[model samples]
Target: MVDRTNADHDVLLTKEAEEQTKNNGLKKKMYKIAFVVQRYGLEINGGAEFLCRDVAEHLSKYCDIDVITTCAIDYVTWKNEYEAGETRINGVSVKRFPVDFPRETKRFDKCSEKVLCKTHSIDEEMEWMKLQGPYSTKLFKFIEDSKDQYDFFFFFTYLYCTTFFGLPLVADKAILVPAAHDEPPIYLSIFNDIFHKPKAIMYNTKEEKDFVIQKFRNGDIPHDVAGSGVSLSEKMESNNSHSLTRKESFITYMGRIDESKGCGELFDFFQRYKKENHSPIKLIMLGKTVMKIPTHQDIKYLGFVSEEEKYNTLQNCDVLIMPSKYESLSIVLLEAWLCKKPVLVNGQCEVLKGQCIRSNAGLWYENYEEFSECLNLLLADEHLRDQLGNEGRKFVDKHYSWETIERKYLDLIERV
Candidate 1:
């Protein structure tokens, strides 16, 4: 009888121990993910960096997220602007390492001119990459040592030094978000290795995925069009206080006010339109300015704005114009659509053109004449603008909802 009681007690204890273990396993994180980017911060609004942050924060709901980045804010100079260490941003852990050296713009440009315009060896191209850098050996060493800690590492933007060097270290567990567009640097021989090394690739758009596959012939690697999501508020209040006048019907441009973004062309076209047609239409620009703003009463530059102000201004605008000729995916375009607004984009950009075609939510133009015509048409017909804007909102709802985006990412992670 004593032996029987002792055996029963042992069985009960064993069952309790097994139950505790099962409970602990259930509470463990689904996966550990690390996002590696060139720059990261609340203030850093560069496309690739911002995309990385958004994706990381969103994914944090399901898994553990860590952002490995450089202490740089300025992309042109690669100047270390953040403290070198780990910190939490909106719940995700961020590890920032100091940039080994700041970029010399003249030297980088000289190197670029040589590499792109003239015959260059792989060695020369690699040198150019180092020059176009947020290079940090400490960051690389940390990645190497800690590779086993994370289930996967997502390296954002193939153009940067961080992705170029860091992705190869954990190629077996690397997922490359190559925010590549139709650009000259991608044709370089060094990129062939970068494209092929990743375990998988996440593209911003189908256009980008197709372009990369054609350029790099990297179709064998698993890839998906896992674009980032745009979260919309339940109610968006349109505040017209930021405008010069509440009654003015203005078109707005939001992004880096730099020449490369086709802002120069936009300024020229808008100024010409104002001159040719004595219309009261104004051009309101908001973002960090890198180029000189033309001195014209019709063109207003509202440097940088808050999120609420941005959406409010978007709601007030007659149209949103994205004049950039090169884009993998324009988040602002999505934002404009989310606000139920029509957009005018540069047709020369295949991604932008394709998006416009796919969604039927915006118009595109290759030249100034087309720009003027499209602008006039959209402004003249309120019904047409409403139709396009409604279609855009539908497109965004079907495709870019946070739930859909998160599912795609989670599915890819599971599959890969």
Candidate 2:
């Protein structure tokens, strides 16, 4: 068993003393692990990237952790944003390699349209993958050269070039965190190779694990559904007089404001409900908006907010809305539950729907009618809202606590 509790003591032993202890067959092995991802930084709010950083930091307590990533920050164009070199962030070592070239959006979109909508050959799909890239030869070389240096290499997000190409180089020791959802790229022939090559897999949710198994027929691989952890903010515990005032009942959405996230559909449904019912309820959104937000009296967009402000707002809101149609695991959904708030999510997403059914902590909507009806039901009954919210908090505490998540990860690592 790994001496997780005595990591400090183990590190204090001198090199010669450690060698002597090892010669005596009494030394405990300290695992060295590497996390490979496309983009990594404090400001990168993308779901898979954030999860990689969080898990790396948490595991650093018991293992030697290093993050291998690209210098790009912008996912859309894969443009280099950070300096291409080694650095330390939050005590984790990060080594970044520059992307060979920034992506051309128009070309990539055209390629995607052809590959996704129309039948294409494997070569055409490979070309599309190149277009959809933060292709870094240097990163690949580093992984190939240093394969024996770490006990295992964890590749995050199956869609990225980093995992697509890098995993095969270190397949004997690669553990994939696919972070997959129902998407077009997943059905491609290349991904079969990526999925089958990993030594083991860490899935974010059971829905994702089932989906991948059914799609790739790779159920034989060792795997675990180890979802990311959520930590409660201390600021959320303290009362802030200047925080959002809940004079009228409101539903809040917190995430990247993009059309693909089902935000446009959410806006339409909310606006129609307001007009038809003449309800005093409002819709509040907090995130970086990538699309044009409709201007209206009932719709309010407060741009990117601080963690304290987010939790405080979540505490005040009647319902937290998660409109994203594709999610392996919604961290914000977990965050809302941590705040003891009920959530409203799109039912089309199997992961979100499964989470709701399992937790019994939120409501889902398939269409505008269902959306409006569920919203009205949650708004009209304060007792029902509180009941759901309390259930959600219990669910989060039971499954998503940091201790539970950390233990799951360490166990999986040891088993693999």
Considering every candidate listed, which one attains the maximal lDDT?
A: 1
Judge candidate 1 against the unseen true structure and give its global Cα lDDT, from 0 to 1: 0.87
Per-model TM-score versus the true fold? 0.92, 0.92
Model 1 segments beyond 4 Å from truth? 1-29
Clashes of 2: 0
lDDT digits (tens) for residues 1-416 of candidate 1: 01122231121224543454355342223476789999998887759998999998777766667899999999989998899999989878899999999999999999999999999898999999999998999999989998877789999999989999999999999999999999889888899899999989999999999999998899999888968788667435555357462568899999999999999999999999998886889999989999999999989888787777788888888899999998999998988898889999999999999989999999999998999999999999999999999999899989998767777777778778
lDDT string, candidate 2, 132-163, tens digits:
99899999999999887778999999998999
Tell how far residue 332 is off in model 2, in angstroms: 0.9
Please give the TM-score that candidate 1 achieves against the real structure.
0.92
